[model samples]
Target chain A: MMRRILSRPFAPVLALAGLLTSLAVAAPIYNAGGGAPRAVFLELPARLPEPEVALRADPLPSGRWRLTLAARHFRFTDICVLEAEAVPLGHAHIVHDGVKLAAAYAPIVDIGPLPPGRHRIEAVLRAQDHRAILGRGGLIKGAVVIEVPERAGGV
Target chain B: MLRVTSSSLKSGAAALIIFATAPPASGHEAWLLTPSEIEALALTPVPFVFASVAVLGPAAGLALLAAAVALALEGRWATIEERASPWLRGLVPSLGAAVLRVGLAAMLLLAATGGLPRHGTAPWTQSTLLVPDMQLSLAPGWDILIVVQVALALILLLGIGTRLAGGVLVLLSGLGLWVFGAEFLSYAPHFAAPGLMLMVIGGGAWSADALMRHDAPDPLTGPAAEALWRGARILVGAGFVYLAVAYKLTQPTLLIAILDHGDFPRFGMTYDVIALIMTGVEIVCGALLVMGRLVRPVALVILGAISFLAVVLGETPLFHANLYGALFVFALAGARAPGPRPSRAAWRMA
Candidate 1:
């Protein structure tokens, strides 16, 4: 039995099996305890009242629209520009019809005047790293829909 | 009986991980997500995740033992490897290097033109240096990078001034870090790895440089060659480790969210479980590359996973074109020095 197990073919096959195990099982466990210092997403628990946003869009004279946001429990700040900490203080991402339009650092931002149709604008709360912040049930976001009427409306 | 049980458990764990590794992926970087999509991800909830130390400890031990056995088995099959690996070790490295150079050219061209624009930006509207996340528009006066990228693409495509191009890539990665800050962390090491490899293995047979400088000497014979080749492997491995740790392990919600957003095929694993498995596999693969064990196979597996993610995520493969090129080089050249290693062709180079 020993001789058979020690044979070249058998030994090589055994080694290959061992290698596969090592790659699949061991390495992942080794690093389970270690993680990057900062987390991009910040999860606010149910205990903290969920933050909310309400968006208002005004057609500007320059074929653009200015957006104003009203918040209930969140504060907007640009202090966490370089890092993604699990902090609620950061900018909001302005999303236009499922496309991220811009980062609203303050209470207001400027977006497009649209191409003359109905449009949906959403404001989602974000952490310092641009990661969406999650509240009690889901994403802390608010939306508003408006009609562009015509391309010449804002212009 | 306990010993038998332990042995069985080891084999079972190995088999289980193997089964899980198949078709295991979520998606590549979803840096272009809009606000609504991000919100949906924020709402995406993971049902359950399995992280019992009881299972992990034994399996991890078995794997460590296996790695040791594999290391011991390395280079023991010189006769078989000498005959079997000539094609893999000889023809493929040069060919793979060329492919990397060409792939890099394509990526650089895309960066200059913003060809793979996603979500918010239209094609040709967003000009980033390397990734969509690194938009050059964020920094004024850096529009010069467009011309620089175009020039680099042309140079890389032709395979001339290849080493100089690699240096430029390294410099650009450093510059991106300075300009974009830590946001560039996700991309810096990955870009630097390819640049370093290009510097070491410049313009293989398929380049204008090779054609023009006929009979160009192989750079593999020097002592520095070994170190440079190893450097590329280490960098790629480190990139994997960093990504797994920063994005997946540390911020698992992000990975779970990405999986949800991409609607990745679960294969019966929960999104969180899938995230855990992916995280673990990346760590193992990356560690293998760094340790110079079973490099070709590990690289091939990583490539397959990346390709799968691209298809499932409905994104252009160009999103990870740079990684594709770097992995191809690794799969072909492997962890061994190309030829005449001061040491034996470490582990057959296959």
Candidate 2:
């Protein structure tokens, strides 16, 4: 009888049916759920390096002011920073006259034509998740004063 | 007079203040980096050349290091196992299985609770859908699905109707994959494999099914049950091994990036070397699990590591799910229950 069952073409079908029946009788549990979102990481200033930023702006031949930024106590990874936490490894967000400019990954960045007046350019060190890197005092930021001289033709 | 204790206390207080008030900073987006990007990061020259060297050696070097450790401990491992077996063998397995069942049931209940804002969390509410296109929508027959999910979990937890629960789980998981498309396959295959395995084994001797059988002899104790257990083990083991290789070994740049993100490099240790060491441990543990060598110990170690990562990397629900799966593997491997002979009705069809 066993041989007959094994030899039959419907053996696969029978086996599947039995397997399904057994499973049905013995109910099991699985994981398909999600969990609440929480803060990714916390960086204490004691463990953090005193991040410093220096900014330089030079008039380019193309008429745009080329801004060069040198950051100390920070690292950059083009890798996604939203999920993982790394200390001191993050990008810099540039701000001009309190208006948010752009997030920069590289040291050298180009700034478009600024109005001929005194302006403040700030480089703020940010964590990988885009939160501003903070010290006990306040945000880790550096500012440089730039004077955009009036062009050859006065308005 | 300046005392050493006073100086230490001052520094400790300063450190405490720093940690207590520090605001959490945003980190990287959750995603896997490509192999090439990782390679580039590993080879990138930095001022800390020595640190880079520590992290940047060939994979063969790691393999050799592992082999050396194994060879050194070869003689003692057997003796250690012999000594530990009597005490460690009996209690851990059964307890681990019960925990696994409860954990799995809880996760299922959470999933069954349906999508957000009702679920009120990303991992729970958004877990049922992946990408915008799969269109499993938050509404519709979610009520029915929740009812089924709760009923099945209760049956499985009681161990009274495990086979039925397993069948339903298999069907549900299958349907989930079909609806969610192949993208979500990587997320929950571990849950599905164990469901089928339990169906074959009839929830072992500790279950209500066993109590109902009441010395009638468990048909699952036969060769078929053994095969099912082995299959489940292999599936889990293989899944972990693949992750170890793909995420840790082949593309350690990503690991380095994560370590760097954690500010691990500040302690004068090379993140690259740290990455390599972590990868090596993952590979060795994963391989041991796959080969069914020292299964209980390996599972425990992997479980510990994963739990730690879940906390350190971020406590996502997915990580919690993985933890439950590891616990199940531990139960399956450590269990040594006596079961009665198979009932004729079970094998009647054959």
> Would you estimate the TM-scores of all the predictions?
0.70, 0.49
TM-score of chain B of each: 0.80, 0.63
Q: In candidate 2, what are the lDDT values of residues B1-350, reduced to their tens digit? A: 12333332442343233223322211122222222232234333322211232323334345435534553463476476545444433322244345555666666665554332111124444323212112244333545566677777687677767766766776776665655443334333466656655565455456777678773123255666665565556556655544443344333445566665444433465675566556556645544444344456656767777666656654454435635654544543442221333234433422
Provide i-RMS per model in Å: 10.0, 26.2
Candidate 2, residue B61: the lDDT equals 48
Q: Model 1: per-residue lDDT, tens digit, B39-103?
A: 55555443233234554455445545655555566566344445556555554436766777888
- Judged by DockQ cut-offs, the docking class of candidate 1 is incorrect
TM-score for the first chain in candidate 2 comes to 0.65
Q: What are the fnat scores of the candidates, in the order listed?
A: 0.13, 0.02
Clashes of each: 0, 45
Off by over 4 Å in 1: A1-52, A57-68, A71-121, A126-129, A133-140, A144-155, B1-28, B32-37, B43-81, B92-94, B139-144, B215-217, B340-350
DockQ of every predicted complex: 0.16, 0.03
Which residue runs does candidate 2 get wrong by more than 4 Å? A1-155, B1-58, B64-89, B92-94, B114-135, B138-148, B170-177, B200-219, B250-253, B260-268, B314-318, B328-350
Task: Assess the local accuracy of residue B117 in candidate 1 as a C-alpha lDDT between 0 and 100.
Answer: 65
